[model samples]
Target: MPEWWTYRLEDFLLFSPRVYWRMFELHNAAVWPLQIPALALGAIILVWIVRPRQWPDLGSDRLVSIILAAAWVWVAWSFLWNRYATINWAATYVAPAFVLQALLLLWIGSLRGRLHFAADRTVRGVVGLALFLYSLVLHPLVAPLVAPLAGRPIQAAEVFGIAPDPTAIATLGLLSIGAGGAIAWLLLAIPLAWCVVSWATLHAMGASESWIPLTAAGLAVLSRLWPRIGSGALR
Candidate 1:
């Protein structure tokens, strides 16, 4: 891990635009034209692995399920951490979380069991382990590359809407209104909602800095224990 105390904001800022710009472009509006095919490919791979013996005849709309699954993962990840104010090691960890959630939700939404445990375990384990190692060893060097894109920092209480000031309220209100009410609502709601819940759950247990990992591990254990139960149970 990089020495957080030694790293300056400018160092991070210098690194983010190049890496995150590509990620943004791939995920942004201009890529909508390619989404269908990409989604279709994902669906095909999912189907091939999960329930290869019992393929569904969804025909042209097979991609719809995959697309929906991907969207759900994005929303879930954003919901998990966006409300938190700090952009430290934990924030750096969200990328892996997003990918993990995306893949699992993709499998869950398939319904047809289009992706089986063997393939799922291989992919998840490999990717998860790689991410863990990267986050551990390369974090200091790589972190600066994406630091530039970190949004304006805000107070923890302000982020959670505990003690909002007039300026903060107006700024967030404008952002919400400008992005369309629904987008704004997510920006405001998920953090205030899930973060608060996670925090409360952690606090009640008298845990602190390790809360997120503990919560994540607990969820992972639950997920594995009831693999047949589906996303609704764990999600």
Candidate 2:
């Protein structure tokens, strides 16, 4: 037997790249039509962040939390537990974390009313909006556009709320908006961890897009920490 150190990441992979992507395709097919309302919910979240006046009460921090909590729960059950676990057994473990994150969002943002968001033209805000939009609109197009080049089906595309990557990315973007207090850090923890996990998994699969989640995670950390470092909060 080869030494442990000689083993590459791909050596530990239980599924092929085709199997990985096909899981998404099958998942999308099984959950047909739900994607439409999921995208609509994402648009509503965007509108609340961009034009708060339109929603007023619904735009409040609590409502955003409830919406995000619902998204997490949906992704946990529909995608991670139901679909992903069929391909990767580890997804069964990951689903609980997603559910825990949903609970945290509810307890902190909804019940305690600790989270907040507002529109701004600052560098952080711009980055946040860009990341959010990328996750919502651009991320779905990524697999569809690239998969065909790789001889994979375009139907493997991952949508915002239905998939874990986009959901985690969008959550980090929204949290970077104006979320404060230590609760913000608590909220950021799971998504950031999932981003790293995603990057590792994709990298193991030899996917060129492995950097997507890692980049999002890096930018999120920098966006949240830069302001503090600039203000001497770190010192």
Instruction: Give the top-scoring candidate (TM-score).
Output: 2
State the local distance difference test value for candidate 2: 0.85
Q: Give the alpha carbon lDDT tens digit for every residue of 116-165 in model 1.
A: 21123432323323322222223223223433443311111111111111
Check candidate 1 and list the clashing pairs. Answer: 12-147, 12-148, 13-148, 15-145, 16-145, 16-146, 50-114, 50-115
Overall local distance difference test of candidate 1: 0.32
Q: lDDT tens digits, residues 9-99, model 2?
A: 8876889988888888898999988888989988888887887642544446678788889999999999999888887899999999999
Which clashing pairs does model 2 show?
none
Runs of candidate 1 with Cα error greater than 4 angstroms are 1-72, 80-82, 85-88, 107-201, 204-235
**TM accuracy, model 1:** 0.24
